[model samples]
Target: MSSFFGAFRRRLLTPPVSETTMEVRGFHVKNAEAKQRLEYIGEVFLKGYAYAVEAGSPAEAEELLETVPRDMRGFAYEGAGMGAAVYDSLPGHGGRLQGLLAGRGRDHDYMIYVGIGWAMARLPKPLWPDIRSTDPLLRWLALDGYGFHQAYFKTAAYVRTPHVQHPFRWRGGHNHYTANAIDQGIGRALWFVGGTDPDVVTDLIRAYPEHRHSDLYAGAGLACAYAGSVGEDELARFVEGAGEHRWALAQGSAFATEARIKAGTVIDHTHLAARVVCGTTAEGAAQVCRDTRPRTPEAAGPFPAYEAWRHDIAAQLASSSLVSKGADQ
Candidate 1:
C-alpha cells in the first residue's frame, strides 16, 4: 500500500513520455536507427525514474533497474537519480537522494548527479539547495543535467534560439564556473539535436561564440562516446571538424569512457568513441581520466578545480603519443 501510494504520487508528477520524442520536440531526424535509439533511451530513462520514485528502497530501485539490458542499465540509474531528486523534493519526502548516493547507487555516481540536475529544471527554485552531493568535483554534473533538460525540452531558448541561459547562483554561489558546466551539457544535447550528423553538429557549435567552442566540443565528444548514434567514420569526422578543440573533445570522450567504465556499463559504442576521440582503448582512456583527475579539486587551480581538471585531461590527450592513432586508422 505504501509503494502504491508513492508510485501514484509519482505518476501524477512525472513528465509525459511523448515529451522525449523528436517529433514532439521538433528535433532533426538523422536516421531511423538514431531516431529509435534516442526514443528508446528516453523510454528507458523514464522507466528507471518511475521505478526509483515508486520503489520501497534504493536497493529495490537498483534491483528493478538492473533488469534493463546492461548497455542501458546506467541510463536507468541516471533516470533514477532524477527520480530520487524529484522524490526527495516533495513535501513528505526528504533525504532519499542522500541515501541513494550513499548506498548501491554510488556505482553510477556520475549519472546520478547529472540526473539530480534534471530535477533542478523541474522542481521549484526554493528547493534547489536541498539537492546536494558529497563530492564537490561531481556536483557540477547537476549543471550538466540542467543544461541537457533545457536544450532537450526548451529547444527554442536553449538550442535554436542559441540562447545560453544565464548562470544561476547555484551550489552555494559557485558562480564563476557555472556557465562552463552548463555549456558542457548544451554541447552534449547538440549531439541529439543534430541527429548525430557531424556536419550539422559542428555548424551548430560554430554558431556559438568562439569562447564556448571548447566546452561544447567536449560535451559532444562525451555524447558521441556514451550515447552513440553514429559510426566510426562519423566519429573521426567530428574530430576533424573540432579542429583546435580536438583535445577538449578527447577529454570529453575520456570522461564518458571513465563514467561508463566506472558504472560497469562499457559497451562497443563506448570503445569506439574512446578510440576515435582519445586514440586509446576504453580502459586506456578511462585511465587517462583517472590519471589527470584533481586529487584535491577544491584547491587545484586559478581556473577552479573542475575546469582545471578538464584542462589537464585535454592537455594530456593532446600531447599523448596515442593522439590520432585511431583516427588515422
Candidate 2:
C-alpha cells in the first residue's frame, strides 16, 4: 500500500514532460523546462554529495560547492541536504556535510543553510543522530529556520524581530523571505531537529531569545506534524511542550498539511500529520483542506490554494475552538 501511494504521489507530483506549460498555484512553466531545471538541480546535489563522500576533507566539498553558479547555490544547498541524506546510508559521512556547512558563515549565507535544513527535515531520522547535540551549525540552522518562519509568515508576534538579510531576491522584486524556499527550508529544519526530541523544540525556543515564542513554536509544530516519525504520544509531548504557543503550532501544521494535500502528496502519514496538529481526525482535516482548495484558473499566485486553505483552516480553527469547548463542557 505504501509503495502504491508512493508511485501514485510521484506520478501526480511529476507528470510527464510536454511542450505546453503547466501552472501550479501561480507559477507557469513549460513541463519540460521545469523537469529539466529540477533534474539539473538534482544533478548538482549528487555531484556535491559524491564529492563529500570521496574527498580528502570538508574543504574539498566546499571548494566544489563554490564552483556551482551563485544563482543556483540555494538549490545546490538543498541538493547537499539530499546528498547528506543519501550519504547517511554509507559509513563515515555522518558529519561530513555538517562540517562543510560549519565553515560557511551564517550572516551572509543563511539561505544556503536554510536549504540544508529543509533537506535535513525531510530526510529520515537516523540520518543525523546528533541533530539534538549543541552542534553550532545545527543550532544555527534551526534558529535561522525559526527566524525565517517569522519573516515569511509575518505572524503578528514576530513583527518586532529584525528580519534576516537574505542574499537572494526573487525576479518580481520580492525579498528572499517571500520565496517558498525559505519557508520550506525552515519548516523542514524544524522537523529534522524536532525528530531528535520534542524537548529540542523547547530548547530552540530558549536558544533564540530575541524571536517571538509563538513563531518558534509554530515552526516546531510544523516540524512535528511533518516530521513523518512523530506518533500520537510524541505529538502529545510536542503539544504540551508548546504550551501557550499550541495555536501557532496548529496553524503551522495545518498550513504544512494543506500544502501537502494541495500538491496531491496525500499518504497515510499525511492523515497522521493532520490529526496530530489539528486535534481533529485525519479525515476531518482532509475534508477541510479539500473543501477550501482553490480551483484552477482562479488560483492566480504562487500559492493561491495554499493561502486559501490556510486562511480557511485558521478561521475555522479559531471559530470552532470555543464551540468545541462549550460542547465538551
Every candidate's lDDT: 0.83, 0.47
lDDT of 1 by residue, 210-321 (tens): 8989989988888888899899999889999999999888988898899999988889898888888888788988888889888885653446677878888888877774
TM-score of each: 0.94, 0.43
RMSD of 2: 18.5
Model 2 Cα lDDT, one tens digit per residue, 92-154:
446655565576422113333443443343445454334334332223343344344343234
At residue 172, what lDDT does model 1 achieve? 31
Clashing pairs in 1: none
Return the top candidate by TM-score.
1
Worst lDDT run of 10 residues, candidate 2, spans 19-28
In terms of lDDT, model 1 sits at 0.83
Error (Å) of candidate 2 at residue 186 is 1.9
Q: What is the C-alpha RMSD of each candidate to the true structure, in Å?
A: 2.3, 18.5
Check candidate 2 and list the clashing pairs: 26-301
